[model samples]
Target: MAAKPGQCTERPKSVPGRTAVLPWRLAPGIALFAAVALSMIFAGSMLGLAISRPWLGLGLSPFAPVAKLQDEGALWLTAVEGPAARAGIPPEPARILSIAPLGPGAAGGAVLLTGADIMEEPDVLPSHAGMAAYFARQNQLAGLMAEPVELHIAALEEAGSDTPPPTAVYRITPERRRPLTSLPAAFWMQIGVGLSGFWIGVWIWTLRRGDWAARFLAVAGTGLMASAFPAAVYSTRELALPDPLFWALSSLNATGSLTFGVGMIGLFLIYPRRLVRNQFLFVPALVLGLWRLADMLEWIDGPALGRHLAILTAMGAIIVLVGLQFRATKGDPRDRAALTWLGLAVIIGAGAFVTTVILPVALGVSAVVSQGQAFLFFLLIYGGMALGVARYRLFQLDEWAFRILFYVTGVLLLLVLDAILIVTVIDERAPAFALSLLVVALLWLPLRDMLGRLVLRRREPQRGALFRQVMDVALTPPGHDQRAIWAALLEGLFQPLTLSPLENATQSSITDEGAGLVVGGVGGLPAYRLDFADQGRKLFAPADVALADELRAMLTNALESRAAYEKGVAEERLRIARDIHDNIGVQLMGALHSLEPRRKDQLIRETLTDLRDIVNNASNPELSFDEMLADLRAQISEHVFAAGMRMEWVVEGGDSVILPLANAHTLRSVVREAVQNALKHADAGLVRIVIRQGDDAIFARVEDDGKGFDISADYRGNGLENMRARIIALGGDLSMISGAGGTRIEARFPFGAERRRR
Candidate 1:
């Protein structure tokens, strides 16, 4: 709908596509993303709490000796309570050799915990799993005990024989459980990693709405949160959990693993360029999803075989896709560079996880790192992805790094200031906070701006100053000197590491994966290359290309204007030459032919004087208006006397100002021509010249009291024509009146206009 004449309809505002805020079209997704993200974080924290809580809601718990901790593979009694602790068992490092139920349901089996069984381990599953399973089953059996249990405890070589001997046997009923105190660092670490990945994905997605790469990255982030959040609960369990609950958490973990595999696979297949069709991505998804489902249902024998296999297969597919992308991106340095960094992340991050956690579990050995610690390796994945995004944006490395540095510094400084004010000095929170803000504003912010400019070292030349430099370069006569000025100006702007002659390339571009900035010739300056911006600290970005183009445009315009001005100067010199030939040449020849010495001498002197005046007027600087007016009077009187006519020169006004030297020659020539014409052809006995000066302008007239011819008649002589043209060229006017009265020629000059004076 159109608005009425006086009404206005405002367009909606949206965040730019380059930054973090979502555009209007994509803003609706933020709510969904936030809801899901908040729920996931909350759920993860609760799950951690659930793992440490008392099972079955009993005040007294079972499993007096907590065994087979995740930290050390060997059984260590992390905690002991109830009958076991009362019976002289210490809360110290001790191995649980075996646990045998003494009542009903006990005859079926004796669980051996933490040590190798006499029976050979299964070929498919690692021996480590056997020990872990025994621990879990023992904890479960003890918790469900109706009567009592006999536990065999063995001590390591270092355990002393004190209250408990090297080997002790205890028949005790377990009834105590330790209350939850706190969660481990690994728990919060998992949350932190998940949240970081999620936010990074959302940040990219919002900035680059509708991009398939960003969409897939968000999906990958979802997978990261999913896998890590659930694993944080199950992987860090203290003693034991019920069969149903244990399996349920494991199932979620497996699902998260499979989901992560699918997202990662899709990410590689589509990023940089879509390698496969959208529907084709479902092949990996379905296959991995089914594999994980089958693992959960016990269709697969070994623990996590399906999950590990799915991950390995996805990793393999990612390598193949990256290889294909490498070949496809040949000669496209930017895409190739981004691919290199992202590909390196997959190799380094996932490879570390596989080597430390997955492969070790498969090979029946202790992992190099704990499972929770293994998750930290994938931080490299998110970090690499972020780096790739920055590359695509074409940010100079130094500039990007400095922005991050200053941002972090600002945050830290503000925090420190707040701590100092609130904790040490100020008594009230409000005043302390206000003081902190003030300090940060006065100190940290200014420091950041100052340090940031120095670190980045990109001088964005002001438009006026840049114009002046470009004009300097343009005005220089074309050669080494002009090129030097151009190079100097570019140096101030870019501060490139090295300048080299561009051999063949002749266009403005960010070349060599941003390592080189090449500029084509402008204003006849030779093409040159600026390499490694900021003294080898950063790469040239796309923005630098635009800056170079602007400089070239400015220089081109300045050169054109200078060229036009030079053309005008040359034309003016040509006009002066014509006057010298047409007027002075005639007198010099007559003097050469004269037979009397006096007459020849007088003519020669007068000709020399006129020539001197013309030459001086052409090149002289502006003189005082009063001085110029007096000089004009004396010169005209001398001319009239020489022409054998009476002279009447009048002057008016007492104003003193600088006269216009730019066109003074033209003004003088115009008056001289009018006076000479009157004496030569007006048939006038007396030639009168009038001069009047006002504050803003000056008017002059030359007339004769004699018979006046028709001023409208066309003249072959150039005297009147030259007079009219000269006055008009000064941005003034000349008018002639002749009708049986003395011919009057008037000239007007608006010396007040500075533009006219210059």
Candidate 2:
């Protein structure tokens, strides 16, 4: 059976209660909005930490203490003491090092403290002074001190005569000190967060619009912006900015951070399934943004606003997300488990946030550590959100598990093979070679199976089975009752995998030897012939041609096969005839001539007659040129005698040429049939036979002067059938012309010398 083009089978329904909605629901939208808002708020707080550390209502001052001591001329204080004392230090004059303040109003200040002096009597030093001094240097002491003061301290234990002003001094007089003038770290972070949000919005919009390219662009932009902000702010805080380079870096970092966060969140929201439903979630993010603007305009401090807002927003987002999960599980039990898992991940992430951000802030831990912990929590939350939104667990669990197992097994196998190879072989490359062999051996069967299944899956399901069934039906043996065969075919094709048979279709014509069938369409209409031996028949559809054409082809193939067999038989007989003529014919003629007197004459005549008969019979195998002419003349004579008519036979150009038996048989049959027909139907009086040999063919004309009949109307049926078949089989032709007074039959057989032209 020949293969047909493949097709996809109809997929079976497996899951029930699955419905696709056109657009996102309001609840999911709001939840997603809240998530974005919270993310923005946290991101803003991170940015604030990267900026100036401001003390807002903490009562723990961020400014340093300045004591302006008015003393006699050229007097240097060894130490100064004040009432602001905690537990560690009290009236410690040696603790005073060097202080420099910017001009009179104290817009900027500088202080240098000696570690030796602080360590020597830290217990005696006032705690307030120590704390105030720490804050003053760090925060520039602009709001805390009113007058510039310089404190020059001389150590009591160190001699001052050869010392370069005791190596450190405090400046109490007001001296102008420049504040670090660069863009706030939070400003760049805000820009980054804003840009990330913008791009994320763009991506969401593109996704809604079904523009994949635009979505990708938006995603890329958001990713770049998301990473930029945090990186810039962090870098600025970590390194001293002497120029605009830090500010530029901050801007770039803010942009990058925003891009990253927005892209990641946007992808989560737009793809997979929605987890959030409240559009109002965007409100908190908008509030954080407004707070950032207010800080820029000096209307409010950003850190205070951002920190509180972020905490509230985070809590709100968690509540909304949890509510969404509950809603998602309400009607569909199938999605309940997934929703539960997602909700748990979200809760765990929120817990991490509280532990890292809120608790540490409440305990008054180091701001840097707290902020870092908060950022860690943010990372965890985003990671969990990404997983939930991408439905990574839903589709990837099996695949990931399989990959893990495969890798583990593969690695173990490789290690074992390597160890075995190393132990057995001394060659340096043996381990590698052995590992390669082992890997191939392990994978070969599985790879082959995978390829086979892939090929089968890709193929049209019905084509192969249909082809086999059709071929089996077409090639069923003749004389076996086609009714049963048709029933079998119908049964075989009635299954779900096979094509249904048309009603009333049956086998119309069986080949003569039962090799093939000519099937009929519905209602006994003839269809094409199908041969058991010929595979090409499968290329055509059964209904492509008329019934007559199929029947004609079948008959033609049968006749052609038979003709070939006959031709072979004729060739063998001609070989036998040639052997007899070369030996016995001459021997008989010589022996007859050698006999005595009347006996000699009679014997010679009889021997010649016997030889002629033998030669005639030998021509039946394949006639020589002279023998063929004689046969044509004999046929004409016999026909004329039977009709009681005078006959003339003439032969020309008979040479030492031998024709193939197949050609000779064809010529004889044409002449005999034509002459007999003329005698029976044409009613001829005088008959003439002429045999002529040309360079390319042997032409025989059998003419009769007779009352002729219409050639086309009267000359059909068995005689003409035999005549035409014989001539055609020998690669020759027969033509007849009969009219009013006479009839002529002509046969042309190209043989021997004549075949050279062909």
Candidate 3:
């Protein structure tokens, strides 16, 4: 039913008649619903027959050989054997008596001596001679009689009380036991196939309530169930059933198969992509259905000709599918994946049936598997058809199906080999288990990886990786560029040709055709436009939006980190300015009151040195002890030489060691102030400074040979007080000695204070 030119093929006109009277839209659905309901009733009836036949004992016997129940007063003969029948015992309703032995043991014969013998045996041949005693005396007479024994029984006439004892005796003998019967594989096979078809039909009908393919599938399911019902019924304990029931079931089976075959052909003809007119496809179903009728009625000995017709029709349907696939390949690419899967289902399912059912049965051997069981493989085909009709995404199903199939088959083979080795070669259970684990570990994961790649072909795009690289470059230290990172991330993800702030645009999304998405940037970043045309993709999928969003989040984090780092740098500079204003600024203002030019000039020099040190080490204020000592000696010598005083500086064991910024800064300040005070007030021409390093302390002594001064009077100066306060703040000792030997300033810094400062 290919669509006419300039018309869509998806929706076809409803079939004619009473269905056409209703709204055209609802008629197809109503018709399909009616078809599905009829299918349900037919299939349900078949399942009932399958279930009821077992309990009723139709077509097979459920119990062993037995006779009818009788009363002891009657003493009737029941279930008579051939010997008793041939000896003039009537196969009629009558009363019987027990047997008694006569003559010697080797030549013994049995006779009905008296009626009391029958009464004495409560449930045996004489007293219990009917169905009640059949189990006890079924074949026991032969064991009781040695050699070939003859037994005589007196029986009453039908509908009479008393009768004369028969003079003639009957011979009884034992026979070999016959083997019991079991249900054939065909019985189980039919049930499995039929039940699978029934369920699949129901599922399709329910899922696609208005679809023509679903209605056709229901027909196939009904036929399968009808065919299986008779088999299930006959499988029960063997019992002859009415001929009419068998004929009825067989007719239904044949009709259902014909209907199923027709439905299959029709379904493929119209669904996904129509290849032929629906009306023209029914000729084969009608012809095959007539043949099935003749076969079921015993009018022809066609040798399973009905089944052959069904197979032929199924093959025709497959050929039609191939034609449809060819059409799809040339003109309709969208339908290609669906038809390909349908073809695979047919190939695999038919192959299974031929290998497991038809070939074995044709060879006169038991089938490798039952027909019904093999038909279960057809369910996979039905499932694929349903998926196709519904237009569900196949994704990479066609491309990966074979790879997955091969990988699974290979794994099964490996497991089989492992089992063979464990049984034949590996004797110790522990070693065998270890070897099995090793093999699985080596083979299983790699196989899974290979299969997974085939199935899920989408990989992270190169642009995504490039975006991350840009973010890393922007975020690296010394160049924290937030704007650059944001721009790069957006460009990589969207590739918009005309990227700009969205403020000027009428809408957040660009008004231009083929616009993708708009992101309202936060944290001072302006909104942006993304155009799809520039990226070469006409539209954006949800996955693309999600990728862009994730990248945006990463860019946001990078921006925040950069902002925080810049804020930290700015705050550090401010802190340095405040420290100089509070400590060194107050010292210079206090020195203005000294009144001597030299003292003021000396204060200015020391202040300038302090400013330079603070500025130079603001970023990283930590210094090694050797470096600190060099800077300190340079400051001291400059002040000492300007005052015309000779200086001697010595350092011991100070290399390869470091100090915290606070400790080093305070030590340099204290030394600088002490040397300046020596040059100004000591009045001595020589000054000796010794710096010593101990295991736990740094000791420095500034000794000068100058006139002694009053220590208490000069203790109020800002220089002395600032030096003492700074040393104490760093957990060190500072002391001043004024005497003829010149004032010596001793200072000690503890390692514990340096560690705490760090």
List CA RMSD, all candidates. 21.1, 30.2, 25.3
Winning model by lDDT: 1
Tens digits of lDDT, candidate 1, 457-494: 44677997788688667765566656777899888888
Q: Which ten contiguous residues of candidate 3 have the minimum total lDDT?
A: 55-64
**Error at 323, model 1, angstroms:** 0.8
The sequence of per-residue lDDT tens digits that candidate 2 reaches over residues 82-102 is: 211221222334324444555
Off by over 4 Å in 1: 1-36, 39-52, 55-74, 78-181, 394-477, 480-758
lDDT of 3 by residue, 1-758 (tens): 55321123454457766454443343333443444445446545644544342211111111112343233333334444334444555564444344443346644344332222212111112211231233233223323432344445444333343565344445444222211223445455566567657655655554444555566666667766765555454333122223455435545655655666666666666555556565655665676677776755545544233354345556566666767655755643334544566667655765566566545443444457534466667666655554533332232122233333334444444655567678889977677766776776678767766755644333466865665464453343322244555666677656665566666332233232223566556555566766552243233334455665665566567667656755765785787788788868876896777799888888888888778777765556565677567556645665666666666776776446777666777777777777778777778998888988787887888888989678888788637888878788767888888888788888887755445321
Which runs of model 2 end up more than 4 angstroms from their true locations?
Answer: 1-110, 113-228, 231-288, 291-302, 331-334, 362-370, 385-758
Among all candidates shown, the one with the greatest TM-score: 1
lDDT of 2 at 485: 44
Which of the two candidates, 2 or 3, achieves a greater lDDT against the reference? Answer: 3
